[model samples]
Target: MGIVNVTPDSFSDGGRYTDVDAAVEHGMALRRAGADIVDIGGESTRPGAERVDAATETTRVVPVITALAAAGVPISIDTTRATVAAAALEAGATVINDVSGGLADPAMAGVARDAGCPWVLMHWRGHSRDMNKLAVYHDVVAEVRAELLERVDDAVGAGVDPRQIILDPGLGFAKNAEHNWQLTRRLDVFVDLGFPVLFAASRKTYLGRLLADAEGRPRPVDEREAATLATSVLAVAAGAWGVRVHDVRSTADALAVWRASGSPRLKTREN
Candidate 1:
């Protein structure tokens, strides 16, 4: 999966693709670079970010999704709102990548059920505005797995097909640096839940902190690609079904190398 943030305030590559034409072209470029799916997100979910209205988000993503879909790119709407997801699906998105895992909007499950497309349920404790305060966890890996299971139950109970469900640990949302590392270190815990797991640690703050300077300053977003690539390769080795990344080509190349190294069987089912 490749990220296309059509917002002005995302932590990484925000204003770069806010224009409709630019965003669509970027999606196409990602497709050419080997992304299996192009994820289009209108809102900036960076920590402490405020929510955008549904109308605005829908406006930002529909045109881009429509154009990309027309050009034969697989698209996923990265939104927490059911209305926005429905609108994007209508515009041609084939997947729903809801970061809130259906907790933000109750209608999201119904939308996923009706669409019968893949639904990515990410582990989220709260909205971006207050998520930092909710990072408390005695055992990050166990808690995240249990919470994701609850979300799985919710989706199944809402008439959604279990086979269409995907899980994400939500690296930054409601998670501290240690929490993010713990989830990645024990990614198999989520993969063991019998659902495809999406590891999306691309250009995240946690990675930035990991590569911090001696002055205690976090590394810049663009500089985190190396760390992101390392995480992607390691996550796949740990049995992640897919990885969401900013530099799709680099990650794809790395995965190709991993595959060439014998394409060994991983812990979880390969998609």
Candidate 2:
């Protein structure tokens, strides 16, 4: 998957493609770059960011989503708001990438159920405004893993099919740097949920903290390509189903090379 943020304030590459034409073009480019899905986000869920109104978010994402869906790209609407998800799906998004895991808007589970689209429910404690304060976790891995299972229960109870659900461990949402590394090291914990796991660590600040350049300075988002590829390959090795990213072609190429070394060993379910 490749990420296209229509908001003006996403942590990475925001405002660069807020316009529909640019976003649509970028979305198409991702498809050409080997993205199985294109994820569109109109709201900036970057920690500490303020919320965007429904109408604005809808306007930013709907047109681009409509264009991509028309052009035959599988689109995922990145949102936690039911209203936004509904509008995006109606505009032709096939998936819901809800960072809040149905915690931000209680009604999102129903929306996903009715849409019948695959949903990506990320583990989150609270809204962005106060989520950082809620990062307290005793045994972060176990706590997050159990909480994510509870979210699966809630989503299923609200009518979403368990089969259509995927889970993400909300990295950088409420996690401290240490917690983020620990989760990455123990990604298998999330995968054991019996659903596909979408590991989205593209240009995340935690990566910068983990890896630093020659000067002992962490690379900026744009300069973190090598780090991203490192994590991507690691995640795939650990059995991640998919990874959301902004640099589609590089990761795709990197994974291809990694798999070619022993493609048969990579997961390919056979009947």
Candidate 3:
């Protein structure tokens, strides 16, 4: 999956594709770069980012999704609001990538059921503005898995098709650097849950901290592509269903190399 942030304040590559035409072109570029799906988000879910009204988010993302879908690109609406998801689906989006994991809106599950499309349930404790304060975990892996299962149960109970649900560990949403690495290291556990797992660690702050400079300063966002590629390769190797990334071509190249090295397990498969 490739990311297309149509908001002005996403942590990485925000404001670069807010225009409908630019966003459509970028989505096409991602498709050309070998992305199976292009996820477009109108709201900035970056840590400490403020929320956008539902109408504004719908306005920002609908036209882009419509254009991309019209051009034959697979599109996922990256939003938590049911109204926004409904509008994007009406505009031709095929998937809903809800970072709130059905917790933010009571109507999200119904929307997914009505649309009959895949819904990505990311592990989230709260909204972005106050999410950092909710990052408490004793055993990060165990807790995340358990929480994700709870989400699954809730979504299933809410009438979402079990087969259409995908799980995302939501790296850096409310997690600290340690928690992020811990989740990455234990990715297989999430994969073992019998649901498609989406690893979205593209250019996040945790990677920057991991690749800190000699002076201990975190690496810049653009400089984190190497780390992001490494994470994508490792995630694929660990049986993750997919990875949501900003730099699609580099990740595609890395995956090709990994497969060419004769690792049958690294062959891409749908989860």
- Give the top-scoring candidate (TM-score): 1
Could you give candidate 1's per-residue lDDT for residues 45-64 as a string of tens digits?
99999999999999999999
Sort every candidate by TM-score, greatest first.
Answer: 1, 3, 2
Q: How accurate locally is residue 99 in candidate 2, as Cα lDDT from 0 to 100?
A: 93
lDDT of 3 by residue, 33-77 (tens): 999999999999988889989999999999999999999999999
Cα deviation of 96, candidate 2, in Å: 0.4
Question: RMSD in Å for candidate 2, one decimal?
Answer: 3.4
Regions more than 4 Å wrong, model 1: 263-271
Worst 10 residues of 3 by lDDT: 262-271
Clashes of 1: 0
lDDT per residue as tens, model 2, 1-271: 8999998998899899988899999999999999999999999988888997999899999999999999999999999889999999999999999998998899999999998889998989887788889889889999989888999999999989999999899888889888888888888777766799998888998788667778878778898888889888878877899999999999999999999887442332223
Report how far off residue 25 is in candidate 2 (Å). 0.5
lDDT of each: 0.94, 0.89, 0.92
Residue 190 of candidate 1: its Cα lDDT? 83
Off-target runs (Cα >4 Å) in candidate 3 are 264-271
Sort by lDDT, best first: 1, 3, 2
Look at candidate 2 and tell me the lDDT of residue 68.
98
- Steric overlap count per candidate: 0, 0, 0
CA RMSD (A), model 1: 2.6
Q: Let me know the TM-score candidate 1 reaches against the reference structure.
A: 0.97
